[model samples]
Target: MNEAISLEAVSKVYGKGRGAVAALREVSVGLPEGGFTAIMGPSGSGKSTFLHCAAGLDRPSSGRVRLGGTDLAELSETKLTELRRERAGFVFQAFNLVSSLTVAQNITLPLRLAGKRADARRLAAIVERVGLTERTGHRPGQLSGGQQQRVAIARALIADPEVIFADEPTGALDTMTAREVLGLLRETVDALGQTIVMVTHDPVAASYADAVLFLADGRVVDTMTGPTAAGVADRMIRLGAWAK
Candidate 1:
């Protein structure tokens, strides 16, 4: 399979000299096209840093991040911004929605911001797929946490991006709500060919992924494939990843 996102020996450091701290060290990962992947690691194990650098939210201190065929290191700030906006989609624990906009408007916000016309059928279909068709007329504040996240997923999907980065999407959700959201995310990959890289600590959540990349310190220490929740937990434990 072709790579959608590839991090080549990437490294990120904060501060300088004696005061400097290494966030990621010689980290390399490949997210396959149309693949749903989970990245699991301890709190300070460079999971966020890796995602930020890989997503072009922050530049790596060294090495390269390739999204599709373009090398992010070669782009100017403006160009990088355009590339991120046009080619990437993000979903995080935070809603990051505009409170003033209706759900339909929020879902099509990216297209609107880029001065492109939103396709009515596509928008309507995606909203339905995410189970948000009934909530389209309402604003985020009028919805529950689960409903809000469904909108966020719909918004990310409306763009039809090459890669979707979801950073702990279920972190702020309750158990039942988390399962619903996660199931929808997995459904997107299976039914719509959506490529996703999700950062999560929960073994049950990671089980939904096609492949799980286990990170220790700043490096990929192991990988589990076609995993069940118990299988993933066993592998993570053996890799010395924190269980609780």
Candidate 2:
């Protein structure tokens, strides 16, 4: 299977000398193409740090991070930025859409930033796929939380990115809205064959993934395939016990 992202013994440290904190330690994992993988752990488990490093938003202090087989450490800063913009997509819990831009405009923003024009057909299809065809003229303020997230998802897809990194995507939404958004993400993996690495604290949200990776104290301690919410919850409880 093709690897959408690979990390080989990656580690991230913040600060210096005795005060330095290890956010991640000797972490290595690969996200296979066309898979939906969720990262979950208790607070301070380096879930966010892992996502940032894997997505090229943060550089590892040691080891290698490769996005679609390209080693990020080898690239210049400009090239790394370009690679992330063109090859990677990001979704955050905040649904970071421009308030003034219409839905259509927001969705196309990434392509514009990349100095590329959108294909009219593909753009329309993306809008339709995300169930926002009629709301293209509406601004983010006019949309519901779920609708806003759908816009974010469409924006991520505008570039046809090889990998998508979502950081607690449904964290801010209501239970119903979160479920809808998670369903859309799951569908993207099944229907569009998109590879997604989502970091979430919610067991229900993690259950939407094809597999779930568990982190504890800056290390990956376990992984579960075809995880159910109950199963993930049980594992999380065990991790909590270990922490205590």
Candidate 3:
């Protein structure tokens, strides 16, 4: 399968000289074009740093990050920003919706930001796909946590992006709501062939993915396929993630 994102010996450093801290250490991984991959690690394991670099939100201090065929290191800030806006989508734990905007507005915000118009048919389809068609006129403040996340997911899907990067997407939800959200994510992969790379700490959340990549001390330590919640929890235990 083709890779949606590829990292080759990528490393990120903060500060300089004696004060320099390495957040990522020659990390290399590739996300398949139509796969759902979860990233897990102990606290301070560079999960956020890895996500930032891979998503082109932050540049690697050394090595390369390729999003599809484009090398991120080769793009200027303006070009990179444009590329990210056009090709990638993001979801976060907080939902990150504009409080003043209605659900429809929030979902189409990315198109507006890119100076593109939203197709009425596409908008309706995406809204319906996320099971938020009835709530399109409601503002974020009026929606429940799960409903708000559905809005976020709809927003991510609006662009038909090559990859969606989610950071603790279900972190704030209750177990049942989280399952619903996870099911939606799974549907996107299986039904829409959407590629997703999610950074999560929850074992159950990780189990929703096609595969799980484990990180430790700024490096890839292991990987598990056909993961189960129980299995992931055990692996995290062995990695000493729970102790911290």
Candidate 4:
């Protein structure tokens, strides 16, 4: 399978000299096209730093991050911004929706930002797929937490991006709501062949992923495939002890 995202000896450091901190240490990994990966680690384990560097939200101090075989280090700031806007999708824990816009507008925000219009059929299908058809005219304030997350997922999918990056997507929802949102994400990968890389801490949440990459002190220490919730919890227990 083609590599959707690849990190080659990537390292990220902040500050300088004795004050400098290395958040990622020559980390290297490849995410296959259409694969779903969950990144997990204990507090201060560099999980967030890894995601930020990998997604181009922050640059690596050294090495390379490639998306679709193009090195991010080689792109100009303008080109990188354009690439992210056109080629990637993001779902955040906060939902990041514009309070002034309706659901439909929010879902199509990316297309509009590019000075393009949404494709009617595709937009309709996405709305229906995410179960947001009846809520299109509603504002975020009027919706429940679960409904709002569904809108966020729809917005992520409307762009038809090569990959989706989710940061604690279910962190704000109730258990039932979280389950529904996770199910939708899984369906997106299994049915639509979408690639997703998520940063999460919940064992149940990680269980939904095809594989989990466990990080510690800015390095990948272990990987678990075909994960189950109980198995993930057991592994995380070991990681917590290592964090000491």
Error of 1 at 164 (Å): 0.5
Lowest lDDT sum, 10 consecutive residues, model 4, at 49-58
**Candidate 2 — what's its lDDT?**
0.95
**Inter-residue clash pairs, candidate 3:** none
Worst 10 residues of 3 by lDDT: 235-244
By lDDT, the better pick of 2 and 4 is 2
* Global CA lDDT computed for model 1: 0.90
lDDT by residue (tens digit), candidate 3, 42-115: 99888999999999999999999999999999999999999888899999999999999999999999999999
Residue lDDT tens for model 2, 94-175: 9999999999999999889988999999999999999999999999999999999999999999999999899999989999
Report how far off residue 145 is in candidate 1 (Å).
0.6
lDDT at position 137, candidate 1: 96
As for candidate 2, its clashing pairs are: none
Residue 143, candidate 2: Cα error in Å is: 0.8
lDDT of 1 by residue, 1-244 (tens): 9999999999999999999988889988889999999998776778888889989999999999999899999999999888877788889998789999999999999988888889999998998998887899999999999999999999888879988999999999999999999999999999989999999989999999999888877788778889789988887777663424
* Model 4 lDDT tens row, 75-108: 9988988888888998999999999999999999
Each candidate structure's count of clashing pairs? 0, 0, 0, 0
